[model samples]
Target: MVESFHEFVVHRSPALCRTAYLLTGDHQLAEDLVQTALARTYRHWRRVRDGNPEAYVRRVMYHQQVSWWRRRRLVERLEAELTERADTDHSEATTLRLSLDAALRQLTPRQRAVIVLRYYEDLTEAQVADALGCTLGTVKRHGHDGLRRLRAVAPELVDATAERSTR
Candidate 1:
C-alpha cells in the first residue's frame, strides 16, 4: 500500500482515469469522474487505507455517475467527443466501435454502467452487483435491459458470436 493518499492517487490516477473514461464515455467527464471519486477517497483515506481503497474509490465513481446522470437528465445531451476521428480507416470495425459508443450513451446511466461493468470490465454478474452495491437480481435485470436497448438501437453490436460462446 502507498504511504499516503497523495501517493496512492499519483500511482492509481491513470488507471482510474481509464476506468472513468470507460464508465462515462466522454474524456472531460471521465476526468471529472476521477476527480470526484478521488476526492471522496481522500476524505475517508484513514478508514480505507488498510483495505481495498481502489475498490472503494471505484464504487464511489459509479454511484456518483448515476446520481449525476439523474440530475442532468433534463439538460441537453452533450457530445463533445462524438465527432469522427480522421485517423481511423473506414473499416467495418471502426464503424462498429463508433456505433457501439453512441448506442451506449442512449441507455439510462444505471444500464450503461451495468453494461460497462459486465462486458467491458469483464466482471461477473454477482461481482458487478457487489461493486454497484446492488442485489444480484438488479444487476441481471440491468444487463438484460441494457442489451435489449442496444438491440433496438444498434443490432449490429450484438451478434450470434456471444450466443455461440454461451451455448
Candidate 2:
C-alpha cells in the first residue's frame, strides 16, 4: 500500500503541482499545497486507495486552495508586489502561459478553481461540483464568470490562434 501510494505521488506530482500553480499563481505555494494534499491522501490511503485516489487528492487540493484564499489576504498583497518582477523574454507559448496565469490570478479562487478543473483537467461540470463540494449550478456559474472575466481582460486571447498564425 505504501509503495503504491509512493508511486502514485511520483507519477501525479508534476501535473498536480502544475494545476496548483495555475490555480494559485505561485510556484512555492503550489508545491506546498500539493505536498499537503498528498500528505492528507497518504493518511487516508486505506479508505481512498482502491477507488480513484487521484480524485481524493484533487478534492483535498481544491479545498486547501479555497481555504487558503479565504484565510490569506497577505497572499494577494504579496502577489501584487511580485507582479512587477514577472517580466520575461521567453517563447510565445511561455508568454501566453504567463499572461493566462496573470489573467487567472484576477479571478476569484472559486472561479479559478472551476476553470482549472473544467478546462485544464478536462472534468465535466458535475465532476467539478463533486470535486468542489458545491452544487453543479455553482460550478457552471463560476465557469461562466471566469471565462467572461478572461475574455474581458484578454480580448486578444480570443484571436490568439489567428494572431499566432499571422506571426
With a 3 Å backbone cut-off (N, CA, C), the pairs that clash in candidate 1 are none
**Cα lDDT for residue 140, model 2?**
94
What's the TM-score of every candidate structure?
Answer: 0.78, 0.85
lDDT of each: 0.81, 0.85
Can you give the lDDT of residue 157 in candidate 1?
A: 64
lDDT of 1 by residue, 51-101 (tens): 878778878999998888777775434453446678757776656666777
Which pairs clash inside model 2? none
Backbone clashes (count) for model 2: 0
Instruction: Looking at model 2, report the run of 10 residues with the lowest lDDT sum.
Output: 75-84
